[model samples]
Target: MPRPPASHMPIADALRARIKASEWQVGDKLPSRAHLAAEYDVNPMTIQRAVERLIIEGLLEGRAGSGTYVRTPRERLRMVRSRHRERRGGSPFRADMAEQGRRGTWESHSQARVPAPDGIAVRLGIAPGDPTVRTDYEFLADGMPVQLSTSWEPMAITDGTPIVLPEMGPLAGMGVVERMRSIGVVIDTAVEVPRPGRATQEEANLLGISVGDLLTHIERTYYDTDGRSVETADITVPDVRWEIAYEIGIEQPEQD
Candidate 1:
């Protein structure tokens, strides 16, 4: 009888090396939990834990009713925050993907006239009961899920306007700056704060990753010339999928 693999084989690391070695080619089913457990002389729960870690690492995929299989790693894309990339008319995401020779698109669902939550109210500088349009978005690059966002716009700024629905109407696909500009609101600046977070089950499902994956959470707000917040959003992207970059242009101080 073959020495049942190696009892000391670090389960997760051992499996990861096997997958990397092409022992299990992409789409090839991994060993069953029972099989792995028996071979390692460990509990099935131990095998499950190992598989879950690989899944979170995006090395393996789990299909309902089917066994786990190796997954191909995609190129890590750069999401740029720069003056030109932040322009209106075109979606920054779409433009970034195009620059990288990939196609990008997004789906958004909006609920109109919802009362602002306390936090949202503060962000938009509106009363708690103020009407707002809430939009949820999932962005895809080359047909792969890449980012998710939830945004709120106070109806006080967009009520009865052609651009109220965000993803609907004539200015539908335009960026917030352009949409607000069409209504005579000059969007002079935007702000964003990025933080680290762990992917929740719901976010994992939506982004096609595993729970506990690393995610970058961004709080983004658009302000007009008068410093009034026009729109605010919370955006999340899988850290493994994209690299975040910021570009700032420095101005010359007058030499005179």
Candidate 2:
């Protein structure tokens, strides 16, 4: 049986479908809520709510005293990281650094307890208020800030190690992985999360870009063999200088 539309189909769905159909192109102003209400025979408030939702989703933008207009799609920035199993084999960051002959100095390190952010807490499987060790670094490539990373480790595991020492040197070459191994925490998997957002003031200064420029933020979490979370890190990179590549495969269907 064909099911009917739900009792309350969100008005945004209709607007989104029309936009996708090219009824409205980028920079095109959408009709006012009153006009849409008259056309759809729905309440003006419903149309307003729908338009608000579209704005929040980046599909539309509202101009004060003007009207809501479609937003143009921005260029996407790419980032590269090793896959889960590949990380276990070798560190991609180390390989890239060696290939480019890049050198960096240890920026800073401190052992202070900080509450985990909502996203970090969820990824680490810890309570939001749980304490964690935070390490901040600014990596330079050819004397320019190319990578900014902040790493967090749960106090329970890292308190006994020199994980927060400033003189630890480049993690890729410094046998930090070996240290973790000595501690009996074998990393089995690493997961990377990519997020698109505007660069912060500090990031803008470091990357030599105007504040609010688009950037690709990445957060990586490493898991130990016992299924426990070992480390979580956040990295930010300028959108222009890097590209992410992926490989995909397609399986053929059975003979018809």
Candidate 3:
């Protein structure tokens, strides 16, 4: 008989076990990165990465000036997706904007330009300095600025489209998918990436929050029929009120 393979686990798992065993408790500062590095016999970067994984898993929280602390045990957060496909249809930005409009809130388009940023350029498969339409909007929900989005499009394709207009009014009634279809483009796929970061001064001012507050940075890329990039957008959502859901497949072994 072959021997079983050793299990490879993340460092966060070890730290979590310590927390659960009461070696560390809520409000207790975790060991410094250097100290943890020595204890684990690993490099500082490895320790840092482990800490980051814990932060994302909500097993720990970081204070700007103080230190990292063990998070209190709380109810496990389970995100449920809508059962009906229709209810799940539409771009997230469009859905949020529509809800805001229904609540008597509105968004103001603050910036629209043609110069592409490095990140957007790479996603759109264009030169860093290539022409691209950039549109920034401040979304108000319940009469309060709650979210901000900056969307980009390849100018060669969208510059002549009516959707490039400064006002987001026309795009309001129709979602991005519908708008793209009207222009002979079909968005067949989308990819979303989420990262954690502190809100910038401008973002804080618009969202009425203090700078350095935790925020979710979301980037979405849409691909057209020919697998060509159609649009790319970056959105910032404050951590306190935003949530996302995804449908993932889980494979189970057959019963003996």
Candidate 4:
């Protein structure tokens, strides 16, 4: 048997229904917490929780020093992941944003000679404590934070090379595929596993969303033609602001 719903769930549902029915139109300020609590015959804290739920759902928004109001729904941007994107030879995130008529920019920091952790070692097929280069990126569209990425590459493959640092050297900001190619490593495939999660304090602060909001965590890795893991990354995207789309290509059969 399933457990009973939380006390706040029903309140959140009722508020959502009213918004959907147009009882509260976009940009309309909601009733005060005390007023809502009086109407629902519950504590003000209960009403606050319900409002917070709606805020996280994108049905409502809170302005500091102002009040909670119905939100104007934002059109979700589609982030396409495909092999073709990797072959484009530049910043795929920028290209993706350009396709949507938005300017894409990112702030990244790279650190070299870091020891790989146990989990990252397994993904990169290297021993724990192996030297690697790590890069952290905050991706933005139209100046709004949209995604976060942490990438790792084994130092053995790139040590002493010009592309050793991801954001510097001759191939600065060229992305993994082109940067690797500059060093004679041909990347042939990438794998991604997406999982659902809730935002933590740090992620929420950086993303400008409430803590515990919905997020999609993608574990991605790029492999060379020889099946060696060359790069691995963990990417985080907020669900309310973006939708992830995947495009697949079919291979042709050998001609007789």
Q: Each candidate's TM vs. the true structure?
A: 0.81, 0.57, 0.58, 0.92
Q: What is the lDDT of residue 75 in candidate 2?
A: 42
Per-residue accuracy of model 3 over 156-227 as CA lDDT, tens digit each: 776767876535546643545666776798887777788888878888888866566678788978888899
lDDT of 3 at 66: 85
Worst 10 residues of 3 by lDDT: 77-86
Candidate numbers sorted by TM-score from highest down: 4, 1, 3, 2
lDDT of 1 by residue, 13-107 (tens): 99999888889988899989989888878777778888888887888889999989898885676788787776635677788888889898999
State the C-alpha lDDT per candidate: 0.88, 0.68, 0.69, 0.92
Backbone clashes under 3 angstroms, per model:
0, 0, 0, 0
Candidate 1, residue 128: the lDDT equals: 96
Deviation in Å, model 1, residue 136 alpha carbon: 2.0
Across 1-256, the per-residue lDDT of candidate 2 in tens digits comes to: 5333232246889999999999999999998887988788777777877776676556788888898999885444334454422434344454555466765443546556788777778878888978887777776655666678888777777665654442353343342355466567787677777888777888888876546556778888888888888778888876655665543336689997
Candidate 3 lDDT at 12 equals 71
Clash pairs, candidate 2, are none
Query: Which numbered prediction scores highest in lDDT against the true structure?
Result: 4
**Deviation (Å) of 23 in candidate 4:** 1.2
Model 2 segments beyond 4 Å from truth?
1-79, 83-94, 104-106, 162-176, 246-256
Residue pairs clashing in model 1 are: none
Which residue runs does candidate 3 get wrong by more than 4 Å? 1-105, 110-113, 166-173, 248-256
